[model samples]
Target: MRTGMTLLIKFILTFVSAFIAFDLLLNNDISWILLLSLVAMLINYLIGDLMVLPAKGNMIASIGDGLLAAITAYIFDLLIPAFTTSWSTLLWFAILIGIAEYFFHLYLKKDEKVAP
Candidate 1:
């Protein structure tokens, strides 16, 4: 169950990070719009990961999830034009989401290395 728990934590971290970053960077009100966007980003990562489930759970999964997360974040941003989401905003979320996930995964790796 460690894998599952780690995955869930990663998901939550990515969601929260994206939400907070978008809110702070864009200076937008934290409303349903931001919440839904975060959800979309999460969904994108989940679906992309599932699609590559046969990759023996390697870096491919992470790469796919990262790409999808960025796309979904952008799509959701566009889902509401009032947010004034530009390519830079999308790039920010994309890069940060991947970085957040990468660091979280590394934390898990470091623990595994220390474990008996």
Candidate 2:
């Protein structure tokens, strides 16, 4: 149950960040942007949030998500011209998403740490 809720939050955060980046920065079509966001969200949640985060901690997990976002965005840009953006823009997007993911990570692991 907790995992499910965390998943939902992760998905929502990824979707919003990706959607804004693709739609505003790249000038992509709404439908395709939505689809891309969904795919990215799922990938990040499964790999970054669920798998790597618990084992490695927030910084590494966020970096993992950023890398995942960059690679995913680059691949999608290759497949769809409208989704294309400059490398700098993609880097910025990844950074912003990574910061957000850090906070989400804290939320997900709030009870996992013992107080000193």
Candidate 3:
């Protein structure tokens, strides 16, 4: 239940961020944004939240999540011809995700079951 809730929140955050940064601003396709959000959420949840958050701590974990988001976006941009974005835009998107993840990490830390 806890993990489900966490993923839900993460998805919401990722979707909104990607929607604003990619779809709304850059005129990217909604379908691609949706796919990006899901992939980014799962990867960040597994690597950043589960592994890094528990081992390294919130600051590091959030940074990792941000980097993961940027990298994921960059890779998608490369693979999908319709997904267009610049480096500065990617950096801005990363910053947004990082800020959200910081607060999210705080919430996760409150729950003992989340970390260990």
Candidate 4:
């Protein structure tokens, strides 16, 4: 249940960030933005939240998440011709996601302390 909630939160954050950067700014299609957001969220959750957060602590995990977001977006931009975006846009997107990830990691840590 907790993990589900975490994923939901991550998805919401990722979707909003992607929507702003890809759809609103770059005029990309909503479907592409949605797909990109989903892919980033899942990979970030798996690697950033599950693996790195537990091992390396919040700062490292958040940085990793940001890098992961940028790399994912870059790959999508490369593979999908319609998904046009600049490096600056991708950088901003990664920063937004990274800030959100920092707060998210804090929440998870808090929950860990409260849980048995």
Number of the top candidate by lDDT? 3
- The estimated TM-scores of all candidates read 0.62, 0.83, 0.93, 0.92
TM-score of model number 3: 0.93
Better of 2 and 4 by TM-score: 4
lDDT of 2 by residue, 1-116 (tens): 66666666767787777767877777777777677767877888879877898789899999989889878888888898766767876887698679888998787677554221
Give lDDT tens digits, candidate 1, residues 1-116: 66566666766777676666567677666674356555754574456444553343536555655666667666666676755456776677666666665665456556664221
Supply every candidate's count of residue pairs whose N, Cα or C atoms clash at under 3 angstroms. Answer: 0, 0, 0, 0
**Model 4 C-alpha lDDT per residue in residues 1-32, reported as the tens digit of each score:** 77677778889999998888887778899998
Best by TM-score: 3
Clashes by residue pair, model 4: none
Ranking by lDDT: 3, 4, 2, 1
Higher-TM-score candidate among 2 and 3? 3
Alpha-carbon lDDT of model 3: 0.89
lDDT scores in order: 0.59, 0.78, 0.89, 0.88
- Runs in model 2 with CA error above 4 Å? 111-116
Worst 10 residues of 4 by lDDT: 107-116
